[model samples]
Target: MTVIDFTAFIGRLATASGETILPFFRTSLSVDNKSSNDFDPVTEADRAAEAVMRRLIKSNFPQHGIVGEEFGNEREDADYVWVLDPIDGTKSFIAGFPIWGTLIALLHKGTPVFGMMHQPYIGERFSGDNGSAHYSGPSGERRLSVRRCASVKEATVFTTSPLLMNPDDRARFGRIENAARLSRYGGDCYSYCMLAAGHLDLVVETELKPYDIAGLIPIITGAGGVVTTWDGKPAQSGGRIIAAGDPRVHEAAMKLLNA
Candidate 1:
């Protein structure tokens, strides 16, 4: 068995992803509509970034499995699998927003063990593996931790789309909003990266698949954050995700969700 050194692999993936995304950062490209909604957009940047990562993974980890947002599953039953969301905030990237990023995660026997989120446009890379998370960029490397906010009233919260939630879910999010110190929208994968970097407190949302949360789990957990479902269970649940700087903050957010 080829035991992958997750820490080193994450550094390589970050470098490769950044190299793939930089050229397309602000270039005017034809955007394709994935859905009738204006918010559902995909661009060449998204495809190209994923393609690059896939290519690298195939070359380096030929035996590993892969699942990507742009590209579907391949070799899914392998002992090692990679979950990818290249250009995670496609809409934001297409609209010239800097919130987009490349997300990569490695799963060992169905458990996430390593992850990296690279914002190529901003030259920021957040990496985590083996219970430790770190941020790298022009500023340098720094460890991250989630906030220890004991109450929702003192928490800063974030979500991708309020519109994607159903009426009841929206109401639940509203209750969370009411309890939070502040709430914001439109961060996408970048929000989770911020959480890993200790800049954000909580990120709650519904309708996330394995790919969406896989890469984020290691990063957040490595940074001393708790990632779980809104019901306070493991985040591997397909329903919803709630990420917080501290376990207490996650529990407090859970109370608001179940309220």
Candidate 2:
């Protein structure tokens, strides 16, 4: 299918997921512990949204595989795969924080070709393919590009939360945070959108799975941002990801992260 054709499907995917999720936002719903430590929270909304998307995919593009946060992979070996995180920021969602959104990505032969982050509550959508992004929100629709802030010292940084990091990763992140002009926490996927919008300069996080970062790469890169691992490799599979709005800042941050 052409890029235009796939984008139409992406739109429908976002809408289906959002409809399933909005019902649970700010309302009482069941929360369960999925992590072995009983700390990683999953809610009914997360599962319902993913289920809705999966149904849509199975109905429309039955050959395309799916990798989701709530449900395990299905036909992952398929050349065309859809990576999904229905509630990318489950913690934020449960906390009534608006920073959470749904992440959707289309990967061809294991490389992401399309990505989108949609927040139905705020009526915001950020999407891209390759290295370009477009945004739609309460204001209007516009193409986005990251602003240049050529140095790390002039940069503003963000991470989901220090608490989410292990001791070692936290220490490593601290070095970068210490170098940035300002460091804010608790943005989840929203901060990545902010970076794409040119409001933030750097974002570093560890322990992310493919579903977490897959949908963000295009949005960030499309807006003239760079996303890579801590050591400066492609971030498609998501390990320790560091995204910088400027290449120089990304280089500097990588130095601190690796040092």
lDDT tens digits, residues 106-175, model 1? Answer: 8888888887888877788887773888888889878866667777888889999899898999999999
- Name the lDDT value of residue 242 in candidate 1: 89
Off by over 4 Å in 1: 1-4, 36-39
Clashes of each: 1, 2
The candidate 1 region of ten consecutive residues with least summed lDDT is 1-10
**Tens digits of per-residue lDDT for model 2, 141-209:** 999889898787899999988887889889989998888899999888999999999898999999899
Assess every candidate by TM-score: 0.93, 0.98
Which residue ranges in model 2 land beyond 4 Å of their true spot? none
- Clashing pairs in model 1? 146-245
